[model samples]
Target: MDSDIFRHGGNTTCDIKQFTIITDKEMRNSMEYDVIIIGGGQAGLAMGFSLKQKNIHFVILDENEQTGMSWRKRYDSLHLFTPRSYSQLHGFHLKGDPNGFPEKNEIAAYLNAFKIKNDLPIIHQEKVIKLTQNEKQKFLVATPNKTHKAKQVVIATGAFYNPFVPNVHDGTANFEIHASQYRNPSQIPNGNVLIIGAGNTGVQIAAELSKTHQVTLSQSKPMKSIPQNIAGRSIFWWLETFRIGRAKPNSFIGKILREREPLIGNDYKTVQNNVEIVGRLSEIKEGKAYFNNGITKQVQNVIWATGYRNDYSWIQIDGVLSNQGRPLHSFGVTNVAGLYFIGLSWQRKRSSALIYGVSDDAKYIAQKIQQHEMK
Candidate 1:
């Protein structure tokens, strides 16, 4: 929470902000609460803010040992595509520049600071392994070490649950890593690096690595590049001006926007000369990666930035999730009583999963939990 931490980023020797982790002795076993929130990332914290306002008895169970582990584990040199103004939670604005993009560490630090400022009750390293309801309709939340009871449960785990890599690549590359594992260019050996998926993460990593290594970017679809700013204004401002960023998922404009996600920053443009952009990676056999366009290249290293999908198999409640392990919900409200979801992509609007946007869903879910208790 120190102001000095944000001042030092990118080639600087400053003490990086570290969060306090709750010790095991401090953790109470078999506790009861009005609500139990799964996942202590931004989504859970936002929900905490809402429940705290209502004086609701709740606790957040985080899998990580400390706060903001989700953002801290991201690849180094990662900057948010949305500016700081769009990358904040409810009642807490991110420190430093509002128009400038924040680095990954800065965001992580902010999350820790948010937790401290609000004094939210969080149980660190308590990963929820199972969630079900008892005969009396009360929810039972089980962790690796303890089982807690709650009247209601909110699954605040964000959309990025698991790293998804296509099975096209064989064990031919000398090294392979997912975007979650990538830290910096130093982690990669001196060889040609092939990055799969043309999402923002892929392009950003490719740009950073291109300066030191030969990087090839494989796109499953056509790359749609959008400038970070337009006429000295952040692109998010444009989206806000037209209300496109907050458009409802079922709306006509939202339907069109959801069809394809355009790259938000110009990182790719700066490294075009250093990196090679290729078509969809169809297959990789014997160290040779074949593209859909008939282009082939010999790659020694592979980095998969193919995005992520949510996993809801841990919830033992029937009809709460689909056969594909996807949560069955209508804007965070599930079919089952006292069970809800938040921080889902397009849960209510385009930014439902975003830091600033998730607050709306959190507040709505908190209200639903309050109503359930009254009934």
Candidate 2:
């Protein structure tokens, strides 16, 4: 990376005095740009594609070695909940079965193709470790080696960062894994498998594995599961028709959207096949799991498909995050000037964080930066 190839211009004279390497914001060499996007996922690509359309001088920095590693890292059996018709980014249609859900690798390939189609300038392996405002009022994107400067910044890092790996004592079950680690039914040790969290992922995985091994899905509360399609049309058609997917987070409809997540894609609820539905798992002890309904199961494998929490600890700015460590932003705009966030759940609407909604948020942000620069 050019950032790693520094100008041998800074103080290099050998001295008797010992000095620690300076990584302070004030000391690093900064590369200037109109905008800097921190992530390389769907959100970042969307924003980059939009900004490119506006002729904005910007760069998207991703930590991973590959542009689509985000999706490639997910469970093998996973596919998007939205059909191909509604799962596309702005520039290109997500290729595949238009009415069917795209597999995880398919989505990743689509994103990578989007990056290429839009000719986005994304620096892979440039993981942003810290972000702060420089004395010049520009945002500083700090990587391990160098700090890049930007007039405006977009935190397009997707919402799902830290996977919620659950800890339970099964007295050394054959094996235990989080849903993120699960690939197929064969990966689980030979025996009954207990899948936690009856949300979309848990339900779908359980249904798939049940065909081979005995599977039980346990959940505390019932999640809202909507049919993938109503009649012959896809559910997305209805969502767009009613504009329910575009509801604001603070709106009544948005509240329900955020809370329930409204499981879709699979018909696990109606026809569970070999899957067993159980009540909340209350305790894990003595090599057994006790349920709230007094049902006990001695399972060989436990799949914690619970969920994930967002961690923005690397960002060092006041007012950008609340005490709970959640970003405070309206749509993609943050309280800190020139700093914005994208791909957050309900960032602008119910679908803002999804593959399709990312385009709208990115376009809005691009427009905002253009107007700001024009002023």
Candidate 3:
């Protein structure tokens, strides 16, 4: 491999610092790679770094202007439930108190720094529009700028790309809101605010906004929450020690927990006192939301922290994705050869989606790719 291709023609050895301005037309018209990784979150970046370590000819395509844009775009008050030490990428540890969970900005900065330090090849602002398999079993990745041909393609886009809002009510258009549009409490006018979901995001946002506005949280079912710490140890420590996050999805324990566990923030109980919990919104008409329990409420803002849906319509490969649009895989390998998925929940184990756990999945996929290449 020519080292110059990895270099920036400057003293800097970091690929993140070395800027390259290749047009989409130029990339589509000319370049090809051994592998092309989609998404630039922790999983994608980790895979790219691992590929670079193996001297594999690969490139990563990200829709953002920089790596870790997903974290950067999150709500301002967001913080990881897991501590900073646990969130470190492969070959690098976060530079701070190990027990402390960093804020969103810190996480984003770490990912950016990790890419630069490792010289991972990433093309930002290059969105993948479609992915198709050719007759030769190679991948054709279509992006806004160009089409890329690669022997293998890794889809590392995190699960949070598509926001899941429930079907709109009759009067939904009359009211304004979706959690994705929420940047801050100021974006909502002062009045009663109805949050339509009771997940971690909905609960957290409700807790924060309740300080100034009357808030009501609507849940379709009763929610459960676990303390961030139990018996003087972080919840994560217990989970890791017992391999809770690594449980098989089909196992009895995994099935029970997945169905019963209510998504909660690091401080679950503390948030409940800050917001009013109510039943699901059965209907909405004339600016009033009707709950299942015969409660009628009038609200000025509705934050739909419902959840997210996975849509891989852009990917044209057959038998790779399940009916839900999530890639069907075992240890990151899809049904289609040379096409893989990472950073998905329950992809390899329960912990596959966590920032700390994604590197392990990436490593596994990287090793698999290496094995395939050797053959």
Give the CA lDDT, 0 to 100, for residue 110 in model 2. Answer: 70
lDDT of each: 0.84, 0.78, 0.77
Model 3 agreement with the true structure over 269-322: per-residue lDDT tens digits: 645777788898887777888899999987667788888887789988789877
What order do candidates take by TM-score, descending? 1, 3, 2
lDDT of 2 at 296: 90
Off by over 4 Å in 2: 1-30, 166-171
Count: clashes, candidate 2: 0
Worst 10 residues of 3 by lDDT: 1-10
TM-score of decoy 1: 0.92
| Residue pairs in collision within model 2 | none
Alpha-carbon deviation at 185 in model 2, angstroms:
1.2
lDDT order, best first, reads 1, 2, 3
Scored against the true structure, residue 250 in model 2 reaches a CA lDDT of: 93
**Candidate 2 residue lDDT tens string, 1-375:** 111111112222212122222232423343877889889999998888777777777778898988788788877778787888778777355544678888888777777766654456778888899998868888888899888888899998888888786665545666777788888877887888888898888888887887788888898787667788899899888988999988999999988777777678655654265778889888777668889999998877888888888889999888999899999888878877788899998899988888888888988988888888887
- Give each model a TM-score: 0.92, 0.87, 0.89
Instruction: Give the Cα-based TM-score of candidate 3 against the true structure.
Output: 0.89
lDDT for model 2 comes to 0.78
lDDT of 2 at 336: 78
